[model samples]
Target chain A: MSIDKLSGLRVLCVEDDPDIRAIAELALGDVGGFDVKLCASGAEALSVVDDFQPELVLLDVMMPGMDGPETLRALRAYESLQSTPVIFMTARLQPDEIKEYLALGAIDVIPKPFDPMTLGEQIGGILDRHSGTTGYR
Target chain B: MSVNDVQASLVALRSKFSGRAREEILFLSRQAEKMSEGKLTGAELSEAYHVLHRLAGSAGTFGLPDLGEAARVLEKSLKPHVERLAATGVADDAIAPVEPLFLRGIEGLFGLVTDQPASVPDSQNKTVEGVDDDSHGTQVRILVCHQSADVRLSLVQGLARYGFQCLEVSLTSPDLAGVIAESSRVASVFVVGEQQLEGVASECRSQNVGGRQLPVLCLAGHDSFEKRYWAAEAGAEGFFSEPLDFPRLADSIERLVSERRYRLSGRVLIVEDDSDLAEHYRLVLESSGVEVRLVSDTRHLMQDLAEFQPDIVLMDVNLAGRSGITLARLIRFEPRWLSLPIIYLSSEDDPESQLVAMSEGADEFLSKPITDDYLVRSVLHRCHRARQLSELMNRDSLTGLLKHALVKQQVHKELASCRRLGYRSCVAMVDLDHFKQVNDTWGHGCGDRVIKALANLLKNRLRETDVIGRYGGEEFVVVLPGCDVGQAQSVIEGIGRSFSELLFFGNDEDSFSVTLSAGIAALNDFSDGDVALEAADQALYQRKSAGRNGVSVYTVPE
Candidate 1:
């Protein structure tokens, strides 16, 4: 069975930097043609996840308070989002750090300075592979 | 929305980011001052780290890669101090050892932010000198003076296909010399019929654009030895026979125009420990319009090489402690820089020592106590020759683009940069659609015209930073740094549409158009350059199978 393309897929992005957030908005919303909800912090992302029912989460690794990992732990408490895939974006991605993120249940890790034009498609590709292994809906 | 709209928005967004970056730098500098004064808190140090981290992560995306790199370096150095401060809840004593370093780093970052003169988007700023106009945003113009209106019309229309906008210079003009002189400032080349060749050529010969003679190409009524001789005597740089072959004529004009453009000054890196001697070399080279960078510390030589990308290296035979020969060998250890010319400066007149230095990767040895004139002449000559040799080795002669191996190597370098700096880039594989049919239908000449046309189009449209290569017979590879596959697809599609509109003349009176197909793969997704290129090729195959003349991004099959 082939997974469908991720066009119009709902995604929640959590990033603290306003400039990067604005860039992500243009990349995912205008370029990627995805339904993207941007949150300024992990706390805001947790608040919006249930209502938005996003298919995927893009979490920045570092934030002022309640960072990415803690946010992921908090996010898993939601029953609907438990199985939803999450990807971490970070500036530093050492091999061990990647292992740690994967161990924390991140489907993939995207480095910072990501091409805004292809961010949505990259996430879609990540999701397709993740679903292939887990037989996710 | 169109790709242009997206690109425009990105430019706007980048300017906004730059403005914000200025304010952020100010905030960081204030924090640095507080730290230096021993009044900063642990939380404030953490804040400074985050600011630097954010700058490192996003500056390149906003078209400030150098600034981003500097920030990354600073962040890496500050990471340990920040972590220790967080653990100990003490900032002043913990950071006292590196306070001066932090202050200098912040000052450097501030310099980088302020040094740039109101940033113009890279695309707009990097138009090739001879090909584009800053005011009109149009192709290089050619002044055409022909006796017959029909011939002028044909010439104008034919040259338009080759990206030249021809302005008609009527033979009936009262002041032909004045007209030619005035137009010579804007036009790159003059294409005149044999009837008016002598007058126009003479006027053009007397005219100079930026101190170089304006080129004139003569269109002869028929091919003859006397006509060619006369044309050459009349100051025409190029001669084309009647029944014009547009491709060949345009090719000649292009070459002449490029040759008329000023050649860039050679850059030389001087690695000398003697401060006085280094300053002397710098002054002498600078007077001759040579860009000179001096390095006193041998430890930073590699970093300097990577940053400056000089055309040649001038080193002293004896450093304070390090041997110049050993340093030359160390530079040659990297395969990428093996071709760089290294000239040693030494007072050692022994032929045996000079030969020893030459064997250890030194290209030439210049004895000390040399006059400034000798130094300038030798360095400039060597720099020019080295550049010429490298271009011959690494570029495809037809397209003036990187050869397949060099482009592949570029992909690997960009991928490694992406991994280290957390940036994203894309590799695109482009092939002309139905190119075989084009060759069979027209001829090899027309086929070559199509290839050259596409190459010119790519060069005109893409950013200067993008690496374009002639990968195969009719296939080209373009590596776009800091672009996603989506953006690459859009850009390639735009090129494809423009390419299909281009007209190529066949042997007969008729002209035909050709189309191109392209596929893009995000560089960071694949493990290496070869794998990424293969994936892009696979996508190209898929596009060809789906009917050509389109762009596709590589997607994984679930």
Candidate 2:
């Protein structure tokens, strides 16, 4: 992962579990070489998205307070993030289950027990497909 | 199963498995089992625990020395596993050692069991077999996160051979929850190994990754009943003793897919006098795979019945002057539609009206202030039942076309506005010239033949966008939307000429033909509908006076 790919990229990660959060940060930040910020709740993600000014967001579908899909909904309220590529990370989803999330405008979903090494790559691939270019290099 | 039975079993299991790590293990094991059984996270696990805890204490009191001693050992062992998993974000490797021992203990108890229900032992039977249908095969999505990319690919390739859509999530860097959550987007099942069970479940639960409720078939390397039970507690819906029983796992997935398919896809029928309500109903239902139809007026009950064939006729009971009960009664009286579900929707709350509506054959009645959820459920229930009825009755009333019941439906569209924003609606009444003479001269048969010919001619001459309705004998009403007097006159005149050109023959009489006189009227948007009809009727009379073969435009007397 190069800084050029991640140079101006900003990402908001919403996850309630710390171990999962840490691994996501490492993958999207160091391994993927992207700028990433983390929030644990849907409400928090909504409030911080503008401040973080992220180009992309990796949201976890389930959270203690506000889950991933709800966070995505809040993300949609911001005109800037409305069209921003969002990839949902969930363990309990099936391709069919993603229909509602996709209808809500998520670019893709990444299953749980994710591989730390390729987490960035998978997200980058989805972003690339949706925006015609990946913010990550 | 009864809560008490579950409790007793848990108690017996707890007492049989007590150890230093017993508490966490028992809790985790029971929870994982429940999860694997398809219970969503936030499911109450305490009941199961209360039973086990009670059993552990009671076993000692009952003086079944071996049972008491065994339970103590199990309980003591269960607690530490929970601690280790929560602290380390992974299931403890310690569970592996107890696999054979736990199974042996369970079997030993089963062997000694006296009078326990046989059904209780078959708890594992609840697991759903996934996506059945072998000849064509199915694409089962698998989420795999392991240390090696090779391992992931190998699993993927293997699953692909079985026609599965294999999605690989690597676990090397941790964040197992994120990976599992992401997997939900692609795979139907997440196969987490024993080592990653605790972390995966917690993370998944947080993400609501299937609420940790969807099937996450665990593959354990060892036959560890303790670990299996632990995996179930963590929200895995199914578990496989490892070496991966691919066939059985596939079967489980098949069952899960079927279960999900059977989940409700609501059906709704919106009987709305308001076009906007009808449109809203269409929007909500179509998106959710609901079949919807709209009937603005209750007068055309039979027409609506024959066409729409809605699972539930969602009626705007108080449509204009007609009561919904009248229409419901009309439907219920018919043998074909007697049991048809009719849901009366109204703003009126008179108990008398509700009772009348119910008596009139409405299966369910809802008030106007209905939530989207309630509307959805009511329609779903009714429509589901309606679908079980035979297929002949689905048709539409206004145009005498097949109703939304038979065809896919779109919202009742409002007219595309014209510049005159006011009631500038055009009404054309085409009546026969000396229609009584034709009836007397050619016997009623000639008159009937001529009327049919005129109907056909008017239909052909008018613009396809126009609303044409048969208005009694020899007279047809046509609504030309967005049309002024000029457009209406021209269309009506053309139909008049076509009616004259129509050649008709009676059963035993000479060939004869008839001419039509049309009255066209355009009303301002604010004009009353009845006033427009009267004006149009007056103009029609004027055309009759003007030698009967042309059209006369109505001009409001200033």
- Work out the TM-score per prediction: 0.55, 0.33
lDDT of 2 by residue, B205-237 (tens): 666611224456676667777876787787777
Candidate 2 residues lying further than 4 Å off, grouped into runs, are A1-137, B1-140, B146-158, B174-178, B209-214, B222-228, B259-264, B280-291, B297-312, B321-323, B326-341, B347-356, B376-558
Residue lDDT tens for model 1, A1-137: 12135667898999999889998988888877778899999999988887899888989998889999999999999999898889999988678999999999999998876756556655665666465421111
lDDT of each: 0.78, 0.56
TM-scores, chain A, per candidate? 0.90, 0.87
- Candidate 1: the clashing residue pairs are none
- Once fitted onto the true fold, the runs of candidate 1 whose alpha carbons sit more than 4 angstroms away are A1-137, B1-157, B164-187, B207-211, B257-262, B347-360, B413-426, B438-446, B481-490, B505-512, B522-528
lDDT of 2 by residue, A44-125 (tens): 7887876888888888775667777777777788888767888887644556779988888888777654544445656655
Q: Tell me the TM-score of candidate 2's A chain.
A: 0.87
User: In candidate 2, how many Å is residue B1 off?
Assistant: 59
Report how far residue B174 has shifted in candidate 2, in Å: 5.0
Q: Residue B27 of candidate 2: its Cα lDDT?
A: 55
Instruction: Looking at model 1 chain B, report the run of 10 residues with the lowest lDDT sum.
Output: B127-136
**Looking at model 1 chain A, which ten-residue stretch has the lowest summed lDDT?**
A128-137
